[model samples]
Target: MASLETRVTEFQENLARNSVNEIKEQIKEMQKMEESQNFVLKDCHEKTQNMLKRIVELEKTDFDDKFNHITRRMIGEVVREHLTPIQMNFNLENKSIKKLVEEHAYTIEQ
Candidate 1:
């Protein structure tokens, strides 16, 4: 009876040791998984930051292009508005000068 009790006690000790080892191994595996997840999270964060920066650059370029186009169009409109009448007046003056020159030439010929 004593030998049988000793054997049972030994068996229980071995089972407890195995359970402790298994728990330790499971903790190690969880730590490794946590490390892997952290790495992926860091990579995703970097990619997101890069994408946001690229978006900002693209938006700035687009805004600048639009602003330049609008400025040029406005300048063209202003130039046309201010210069058209001046050009027309210069043309009329040139015609009047040519007519006076022709009249003077005719009188000289006579």
Candidate 2:
């Protein structure tokens, strides 16, 4: 009877030890997983920051390009508006001078 009781007590102790060891191993594995997740999260954050900066740069470039294009178009329109009448007057004077030269040549030939 005493021998059987001792065997039961030893068995219980062994089971308890095994349970404790398994729990400890699980805790260690969880800690390792947590560390791995931290690294992955850090990497994702850095990449996101880089992408955001690049997007901002692209937006700025696009805005500048649009602004420059609009400025050039406006300047060109203003120049055309200011030059149209001058061009017309120059054309009229050129025609008048040509007519006068032709008349002068005809008199000379006569």
Candidate 3:
């Protein structure tokens, strides 16, 4: 039969051991949760990087298309607004010069 003091000491030791075990279990649970959160964060980071890369590619394609459209429009406007009038006046001047030269040559020959 154990003395009263020895029984009290045994109870105290058992309580300490159970508290340690409970603390260990809590620590293991926390570590598992932390690992799961890290995995989720890594996956989210990868997805965000991919989305940013796709957006850059799309923006480059859109810029190229818009540049081409503006260039074509500017070329067409230059031809219509500046080149056509210059071409018509050149043709008229060429014909007048040719007629003057023929008239002078004929008079000189006579």
For model 1, the run of ten residues with the poorest summed lDDT? 58-67
Q: Pull out the clashing pairs in model 1.
A: none
How do the residues 1-69 of candidate 1 rate in per-residue lDDT, one tens digit apiece?
569989999999999999999999999999999999999999999999999999999877877779899
Show model 3 residue runs off by greater than 4 Å: 63-110
Candidate 3 residue 86 Cα shift, in angstroms, is 36
lDDT of each: 0.97, 0.97, 0.96
Worst 10 residues of 2 by lDDT: 56-65
TM-score of each: 0.53, 0.53, 0.54
Q: Where is the poorest 10-residue window by lDDT in model 3?
A: 56-65
List of clashing residue pairs for candidate 2 = none
Q: Write the per-residue lDDT of candidate 2 for residues 4-103, one digit (tens) a residue.
A: 9899999999999999999999999999999999999999999999999999998778777798999999999999999999999999999999999999
lDDT of 3 by residue, 33-87 (tens): 9999999999999999999999998877878779999999999998888988898
List RMSD in Å for every model shown: 7.7, 6.3, 9.5
Instruction: Estimate the overall C-alpha local distance difference test score of candidate 2.
Output: 0.97
Better of 2 and 3 by lDDT: 2
